[model samples]
Target: MSLGFAYAAGFVLATSTGMLTLLGSGEFPPWLWLALFAPSATAVMRARNRQAPGWLGTLIGGGALIYGTLVVQSQGASGVLIGSTSGLLGIFIARLVTRTTLKHDLQALMLSLLIVIAGAGMNSGVSYGISFVAYAVSVVWALVTRQLVEGAEREASLPFGATLEVTLARRDIVTPVFFAASAMVSLVVLLSTSFLFVLFPRVGLGSFKMAQNSGLPDSVSLRGSPMAGGSGAVVARVKGVSGTQIDRGLYLRAATYDRMTRDAFVRDSELVGLQRSEWARLAHHEDARQYDVFLQPVTDGHLLVLG
Candidate 1:
């Protein structure tokens, strides 16, 4: 029973991490909440011996994978979302196969790991970071409990209550000393990997161009009739002004075009490169002023900046 509780707690923590990551993306649909909660809900039902047929589980898993692939192809769904859905489907199938076995626990662990991977891709917020740490600790507890449960089941044909009671009393497995050692080991591994990552060299290699192409266009033509009209729709809103304002015109610049032809203005292809330090120096000049801006959704993905 203690082992089961640990497993349940770990599963919930890991699942919450995934959900928080998706929430951070700010693009997850409300309808997808059902998908997020389905596996846990099904697990609860199965716990009451209301297990669905194996074939039905297989069908659901296979169909979900197919549907996820189709969604990716048609709607250009995020890689993280696709991977998460795949992992969820795997868990669904595993849950149907066996709930009380070590194999099932391991399967759930792997799926939870997959969800964490997806979460890393989806968001890098502080909340996600905290949730990830919680998940790591929970996983350690889960793994320890799984080992204990499996060992006890193998050693005795006694009732589950007796086996679990014996297992819980084992000092080697359940002692504070063991948990502390495990935690320290996990911490060492984490810090070592992070240190290596910080020391690694980064290569940008035009990845920003790929990002520009994937979601929205990087540039939009401002040399059209839309620029000449005062009756256009509002693109952005500014707030937090307290004092009385004068009736001066406000100008927001997105990009500058150097060459103006008869029909349109074309952007210059020549690029000027600067080092990070140089940019930082330029930004901190005494004549410079800073403003914070909030933006609404723009169809063309062109951000309006001010000089």
Candidate 2:
């Protein structure tokens, strides 16, 4: 029960992010954000054992579905899809509150995934990326929590009590460490999968472009002027620095030219793998500055900033 609330809250956040991303991208109307309260209120009412009859939920859900379909015939398809998803979400919420099975939960999760996928397909902006990350983490956490407790909960069902009894782990099955460990695992999954996605060659998808567009040479020949073929467009965005730091400027070390001639310096074309690991002890200062860097897919070897 302790883990259940965490999972529920995370699930809500993931769904909210997906909805907001779609809304921000103009895929749906602004009022769609307010529709989240339907499921939320139903879940809370059920928790308090004061929920209305299942017929009420069905009526509302059916009405919503019919309205969304009418919307599809008259206007935007994106809005209709999202509206139908939200209606299904509420129906699943009712199922979850009224049953002891996992069918409804899985159905809701899938619908949430559909929303996120739609948003991703329509928008490649930072908001959609953030929505994806939040959805990924929440899905990971919810899966972990559900898998661990499903059997136990089924066995521990009661006749006169609620199925889920949620508390903040004051003296319960889940603790802060459990949440932290799940978050770390989610991070690992996100990083590994993202790296694999970027590293995979997508030549058929037409993602790769001519090196001249990136302002960098594809292979070193030392024949042409290295600086002559590049664009002056922005490649990356850095956050957490002040205006003063931006005014001072930054120097970037993008690549190394190990093989050089008198005419020009050359870098290796297929110089493969190198891996290194070391540990060092150093004095720490009270003040340290850290910032986040977001880079566009400009080159195989990404840009690096130096102090």
Clashes of each: 0, 1
TM-score of each: 0.52, 0.53
**Candidate 1 C-alpha lDDT tens digits along 1-307:** 3445544554555555545554555455565556566547655764565655677657766776776676677667465476456546445444534455568657766766766677677676786777677667667766776676677777666554456556644555455675677667667777776666656524232334443443434444443334323546665554533222211323344544544555665665533232233223212223544445464433232334432
Candidate 1 lDDT for residue 184: 75
Q: How many clashing pairs does model 2 include?
A: 1
- Candidate 1 — worst ten consecutive residues by lDDT sum? 241-250
Candidates in order have lDDT scores of 0.55, 0.58
In candidate 1, how many Å is residue 60 off?
Answer: 2.9
Cα misplacement distance, residue 261 of candidate 2 (Å): 39
Report each candidate's C-alpha RMSD, comma-separated, in the order given. Answer: 18.4, 21.9
Tens digit of per-residue lDDT, candidate 2, span 1-307 = 4665665566566556656555556655566566566446645654465746767657756776776677777777656765665565445444544433455566666666766766665576787777777778777777776665564465457565334442233236567787788889989988887676656646222245464243354444433333322877566677876655654554333553444455665566544233322322122335797877676534443223332
